[model samples]
Target: MSEANECLFCKIIAGEIPSNTVYEDDSTIAFSDIHPKAKVHVLIVPKKHYANVAELAEQDSHELSHMVGIAKSIADKEFHGAYRLIFNTGEDAGQSVFHVHAHVLTGEVMAE
Candidate 1:
């Protein structure tokens, strides 16, 4: 199978894997994170596969921005529009899944 086919997020996008979907559109999907770091933690992912945030930005900056917009919307509804966005770019940076995604964390005071 191709790398995209083997991707976890790809499977989720394809409905092969179940996910707690929050928002979805033609280019992106937002879902609740299974292992959440914050009270309201969601993942904003592109339907199209990219290795990481940098890769996604290089390939489709518009989609990257859309992901951010979705993250903001989620924060608006879940945490009074106050939130933190995280992009873990590589394995060394704590990104386990190769598929590019943005983590939207909110609902409490963020640790420094």
Candidate 2:
């Protein structure tokens, strides 16, 4: 059920697709967004493919938190002013992209 083959993030992490990687470690990768919602927007993704939040139950807690921690670090580096972190889990939530990722947006509304 984990679409590892067709998953875009999997390709990105695997070096099949080119992404502007700003930060990377064994557990996570931070890259610039192809579509920017603010002055600074980046997608923080786990090295392993996860369809969405619902599928995250199979992932380790340490890796999950590490991804989030990397998100905060990237946001602080790029969007020094302020930022918002969001994740859309399913179709109803507007998750056109199934690769479990955190959207870090800055230069936008505080509540966004």
Best by TM-score: 1
**Candidate 2, poorest ten consecutive residues by summed lDDT:** 103-112
Candidate 1: tens digits of C-alpha lDDT, residues 44-86: 9999999999998898999998988898899899889999999
RMSD of 1: 0.7
lDDT of 1: 0.93
Model 2 earns a TM-score of 0.85
Task: Enumerate clash totals for all models, in the order shown.
Answer: 0, 0
Pairs with steric clashes in candidate 2: none
Per-residue alpha-carbon lDDT of candidate 2 for residues 1-112, written as tens digits (9 for 90 to 100): 5578788888899999999998888878888899988777888888877788667646666777787777677666766736787889899998987988888887545642
Q: Please identify model 1 stretches exceeding 4 Å from their true place.
A: none
